[model samples]
Target: MEKTNSASRFVDLVQTKKSFEDIKYWTWSEMLIALKQCQESPSLTNSSIMLKKCIDLLSQKISLADGASSSASSVNSSRFRSSCDSKSTESLKTNFASTTWWFEDLLFFSTECLEMFVQSMVSHEFDQVLLSKFLIHFQKSKFFNATSDVKMKVIESVIDMLDTLDENVLSLKALFDILRVTLGLNINKGSKNRLEAMIGSKLGHATLDNLLVPSPYGANYLYDVNLVLRLFKAFLSGGINQASPSQLAKAANLMDSYMVEVAPDPCLKSSKFLALAKVIPDSARKSYDEMYYAIDLYFEMHVGMSEEEKEKICCALNHKKLSYEVRIHLSKNPKFPLKSTPSSPESQQPETENLLQNINYSKSLISWPHNLTEGINTDEKEDKSSEQIVLYHGKFDLPADNERFKVHLEGMQWRVLELEKLCRKMQTQMRKILKSRVASSYCQVKSLPKLCS
Candidate 1:
């Protein structure tokens, strides 16, 4: 009986040792399971303990992964470098996948707990102060440079909370801080491509429309508008050309709507138009046509713009070549208005009955080496064959800006100055001619009188 009792104690001791070892060497999957069990637990205190334990493990794993990545990069050799790169990429993928799964699970668990706690507090069954304390503690916990997935999940949760909760209850600053934190993260090309795919996905994965649709007819509308605008500006500016065409268009459309309704400032409106004009893809013919339409729209919208704004618009227009039809439209508008008195005295004009009367408008404005009338005659296609050949041969050496207004004005001034100089020279020559004729006539009269005497 004594030997049997000792054997039973030994087995119990062995079992205890194995359990402790298992907890000591917890795998990522095991940590995830532990979090899940905590999420299902009825006791909040026990669940909190379990959550803390899982979070600690996650932090350690992330630290280990980051340290490994940093260390692995130091290894260098032409032969081994490719092998190392492959291994590192595979390791990163595995780590990213695991972290993404863990983040999603945590988000689900936290949101569910938050909702339940909020309900309990409303029913007076949960302590409001305690709930507040829990929130504060959670907020202050060290994230240890969390992955993008974690950041995105937090942003999504904050947005969801703002959408669902009353404005009076949520701290707007805290929510904004969450978004700012996400935006502050380093945006590499790989991340940018993923974000672009998300924004442009026809399936609506991470679609901006789905994530940040504006509210209607309330303070919430204004709130949402500001949030969405900030989010887009940060994204577009940070990523620059990373956005897909459809995504770019969608963002532009949203900003345009905001400009029309919320921001009535002409300069602000013009800015949005400029951004839209820049983002349109110009590689394909269809996209080029779309850009042409955008340029026309921008011109139409900014008709009465200030000189500075017009200058900015002109600068942008000069950056890209417009289609033939668009160029024609631009010629009708000409360039932005110059000041009545040009900065250069040479370009300044005197007031006259017709300021442009002396100017050869057609010759001054047209940069072409050929006849203006022939160029204007769209029906004379055969006559333009040479011009077309030159254009194609030169790979379309088309100028971007409408230099017509400035060139025409300057040319007219120059021609007027030349004509005035010529007139002065002619007057001097004519005066000399008259003087010689008078002298000859006087000599003839005097000689005739002497002969008569």
Candidate 2:
């Protein structure tokens, strides 16, 4: 009975040590299971805390393994330099290579743990601080600093995890910070330029749209419009031509929306807007036009006196006169024909001239009543006839017999009388100025002639 009791105690001791050993090297999957179990248990809050600590410790061990592997690799490489010709050196190299593989496996395992933990934390509503710690660990991991292929895989994993996270629990600041860091590293290494086109292609429009235009917080929109604008600008500036057509389209759409919401003041300038306009694809022209119209409307609404004033404002909005020029260009395209294309050579030669003639005739028709209010003098009639002669050239021929034409002619006649009265008013002011100038000149000339005589 005493021996059996001792044997049972020994078995229990062995089991406890094994449990401790298992915790020390806990796989990510095991840690997750333990965490879930602790979460479910009523009296396991302390156990959960302890498990978290264990997971953290395991993460540290993984980091140490990386450092140890790097050091070992360096040492092995040095040994090759010292003893290249020795038989033992070959054996040492083989052994070192195998050891390195073991370290790599450990790192791979740790990466798996990190990925799972990130997903778990995101899903389970872990503390922001804990999530941040996980992100920091992730950023510091060997997987993050791996080859482009490897890093992209890790990035994809993170993005997938992002999809699963609850919006309320997801830490925007933390995510942004991680993205910023990753982007910085990519930028530093010149990998971001290569990755951008791929990111656009893989993520597609909907994902990007969601990221850029998230739900509004208070008055603040999802992402900072300015920041998102800058990010897209950076991506395009890097080498957007390499991106897929859909990616280019998505980028242009986002940029168009961003320009409207943020209304980048710099983009209104000649040099900047011109530079960016070149990159906008044909697929996104409609979006660009909409943004342009919105900006035009905004300026008109905010600055103009009336709708007519707004029309004038629209004409002047683009500093480079690009708006009208672009309209003409678009109108000329075979795909989008102009609404009022002049078929005849005569009609085409002077649309503006014809428009001006119509405008003058309309003005004459409207001004008839005003002429009657003010009387015309004799000198003013000669000036009025000269103006009427100018108005009647080549185009603008009036019909002689139609009742409507007769009414229009009568109105124009009244306007001519009004013009004569205005001419008389202007003639009186001009005559007075001329008299003063002539008197002064005459006095000077007379004095000059007297002096000469």
Candidate 3:
């Protein structure tokens, strides 16, 4: 009878519309024990209802506490605003004095409630607003600045939440906020500068170098590149070398692959392209040259133009006196070689001069190829077989493969060398064309009679 009365009192408490503070008298473990006993009994309809009420009250209390703690301190009146404004300008000094003790209490309560809530078997709807509030509060705590043991607890809680959450509308925003906080802390300039300065003068450079290399951090390579590129552009514009030789080389390699996938719509802004070119190191100039070669090759193969015809069109287009319509018409012809023979001596004089000018332009294009060749080595290493060598007439020789195999190997080597030569040649010609275009613009600006005509 005493037990029955105790059960009745528990049911009455559950059914009552008690504030969360009132329910706090019953520990979560005790509540769970009561709830389990009620679920086991067949006649406890009121007990089941009471159990749900208790869970709801606990959840709400946890949520409310989290909200009260984490939100930015509000300035409700002119007096409060004046008080805050009159405080120290530095955040550290201000936060130390103005910090609320209630926030710590709230976090403690919420953490306990959350642990209890997870243990309950009740299917409760995740309160997104409440979760967001908790996260906002957590960030405000600057929990990382705390003792390592406390920091570990916070980090563990965050990781657990990240793993379990459904990542729905409510959860995704919370997760993004968490990620922002983590990344912000790691890459914070003030924190990084102090640590780096303590190590050595090359601290910043070393940090950037590690970021460029492949690792877990490389998972964010695209983001890193974008951030670095912005920094690099600022440096270039300010005439500073923000990137090292190897860093620029890595960037060049990335750009080589990136440019191929980029659409060639002239309307698209390519400020990154210009910035990349400016920041690339002299050592990695070959990579940039190769990229330009590939671009030219892509245009040639896809745009239906032979090498000779492209040369002719490029040369003619660079002439200051050439009209756009005339150039376009000339480019449309299949056999309009710039140096084709003239019919008469009277016509040949002007044609000869034009021919000489085109020859000189072609000679200029060859200069880049010569410069590229000066630093390149095309020697092939000899292959050594592990098999025993047989002496024939005092000369040591291994057993030879079929004649066709030897021929195929030689052909493959020749093709690779040929392609390399072609790439260099095309790069040189493209550079010359670009240079000529600049010169033509300058001549037009000067209003030279021969060019302006």
Question: lDDT tens digits, residues 1-453, model 2?
Answer: 644453343334334543444344333334344444434442632554444554554343332333332322455445324433445334334545332322222233334455655544433334434344444445447455478656655655554444444434444444554455454233333344333333433332433343444322343333344344344555555465556777677666655555454333432332233333344545434334554544443443344234453333233223222343344443443322223221322233254344445546555444433443344454665466547647645564333223354446457656666776776686566557656767887878743121111
Backbone steric clashes in candidate 1, count: 0
Deviation from native of the Cα of residue 7 in model 2, angstroms: 22
- How many backbone clashes does every candidate have? 0, 1, 1
Tens-place lDDT digits, model 3, residues 1-453:
744655665666555634434443454334444555555552655654554556554453333323332322343222222322222123323334422322343343333334344333123344444443554566457474675555545544544443343333233234333433444234344433322222222222323333232212535223334443443343234232554555555555555454443324332123443343344444544323344433443343345445564443233122222233333444454433444212222222344334334433333334444444353332211111111111112322212332343345456555555666776777867578657767887978853232111
| lDDT of model 1, residue 204 | 13
**After superposition, which runs of candidate 1 have C-alpha atoms over 4 Å from their true positions?**
1-108, 111-268, 275-292, 298-304, 334-453
Better candidate number, 2 or 3, judged by TM-score: 2
lDDT of 1 at 116: 44
Better model by TM-score: candidate 1 vs candidate 3: 1
Instruction: Report residue 228 deviation for candidate 1 (angstroms).
Output: 8.1
Q: Rank the candidates by lDDT, best first.
A: 2, 1, 3
lDDT for 353 in candidate 1 is 12
Q: Which consecutive 10 residues in model 2 have the weakest lDDT in total?
A: 335-344
Candidate 2: stretches off by over 4 Å: 1-111, 123-140, 144-153, 162-349, 372-453
State each model's CA lDDT, in order: 0.42, 0.44, 0.40
Question: Could you give the C-alpha RMSD of every candidate to the true structure, in order shown?
Answer: 19.7, 19.8, 25.6
